[model samples]
Target: MVSTGLEDLEQSFSSQIRNGWNARPVFVPAEFAGMRGRLGVHDVVMTVERSTGRGFESITVASIQTDEGTGRGDAATSTAEAPHDRVSLTVIGLPELGSPLPIIGIDMIALKGTLSLVALDLAPTSTSFWDDVCEKRLFALAEDARDRLVIRKRPEFAHETFSRHAIIAAARPGCEEHAFAIARNFFTLATDVVAAAMGRVGDDPIEARNRNLAWRRSERQNRKEMNALARMFGEDRARTFIDAFLFA
Candidate 1:
């Protein structure tokens, strides 16, 4: 069984989003609609490495979904399941930021099953506001996925699995500020959860130290980029935008 506790899972996902957003170009002149329309559907393949000398293992052909629709409530919710037709691959690579690198690619798959809710959360939504909400939800799903993957080395999440198989379900779209709040709450919660779990499970001192080192290195790199962004857009505005999109 994989050793992903809920806390670790959440932390891993939160870290991924933080890095992805922070590393992205400061200004994407493209309008939200353009970005949404260009969204790609893909399959996720995840590879996990165990700290306990358990070696490494992977799962392939997982589904990913993205929806960027204009509807405020109903329409936003309805499109959440749109990525069911594609398969995604997530490769674990050398530490890029504070977490493993996910080299993502997508493919179309003929065999259909309900997408694991955890995977569906990674989908893009219609606007920044909706994206923020979905980002928080996705972190939740990531937490669940980490746990299941650690224990089973495969996707698990009864609710998500069922949702994938059933008629499509919609996620509530929220205002940008509200969505940002949700993502922030999830990040804090997930961080706490993982820290507690790590404390309980205990970790190899060497590995822990190494991870801390990697995190610090990543932090330095992020700070440099953040500084550059601050210069491009006034510091205050840059910070505000970064805070908003970091999780979205």
Candidate 2:
């Protein structure tokens, strides 16, 4: 299990939440060998979602580990890790369009250890405060781990095993409201990310290709869904949704 420092961790998060609101840090299993379970702290950053006009405070963390040793020769003979930065997006919504559950995230991204100057003496921008924050997170969707732990779905909840649309569609209970609500969060966050990623270049082509490929798949599918929703739910409702869900 849980190793140590659970109490201290809870106390730290307790201070971040409102006095009356519940802010329990839940234990999440570490999937990889030797990796320890993690606790999720909600309300890490609270704010109103612009899309769908819903409210949420982003979560604390959801991290996953995968093997990254290169196999140029024997496992031991691989060259020094070609450490590079990775680009990843965290979607803050649900398991499906129809379910207001945690997101389904598959993070096999690996980073070779980097050499850096200690941050204690560094400027705020240069400090690794956010780095620690990212490290603590094991997944974008809390239920991704939750499902596997409790067998929320038979055969496990591995995102790698299914397409995004299939995952969302299968889990949907056919409720428009919940699906739209969760989708609103997804769209709102996506708009912000796209706005940020626009005109930006990655460190390399592979990074750009991987990031764009994922984006295209999601965005393309989303547009199709948006069109279908308009036909079924009326253009006015769809228009209103798109307008509210996306950022200028």
- Tens-digit per-residue lDDT, 134-229, candidate 1: 345445544543433221222222232111211112112222222223334444442332232331322243443344343333323445335643
Best candidate, lDDT: 1
Whole-model lDDT values for every prediction? 0.28, 0.25
Q: Estimate the TM-score for candidate 1.
A: 0.24
In terms of lDDT, the poorest run of 10 residues in model 2 is: 115-124
Tens digit of per-residue lDDT, candidate 2, span 27-145 = 32232112221112100111112111111222222222222432234432222122111111112222112111122222111112211100000001111321222212322422332
TM-scores for all predictions: 0.24, 0.23
Error of 2 at 47 (Å): 35
- Segments of candidate 2 deviating more than 4 angstroms: 1-175, 210-248
RMSD of each: 18.0, 21.6
lDDT of 1 at 248: 18
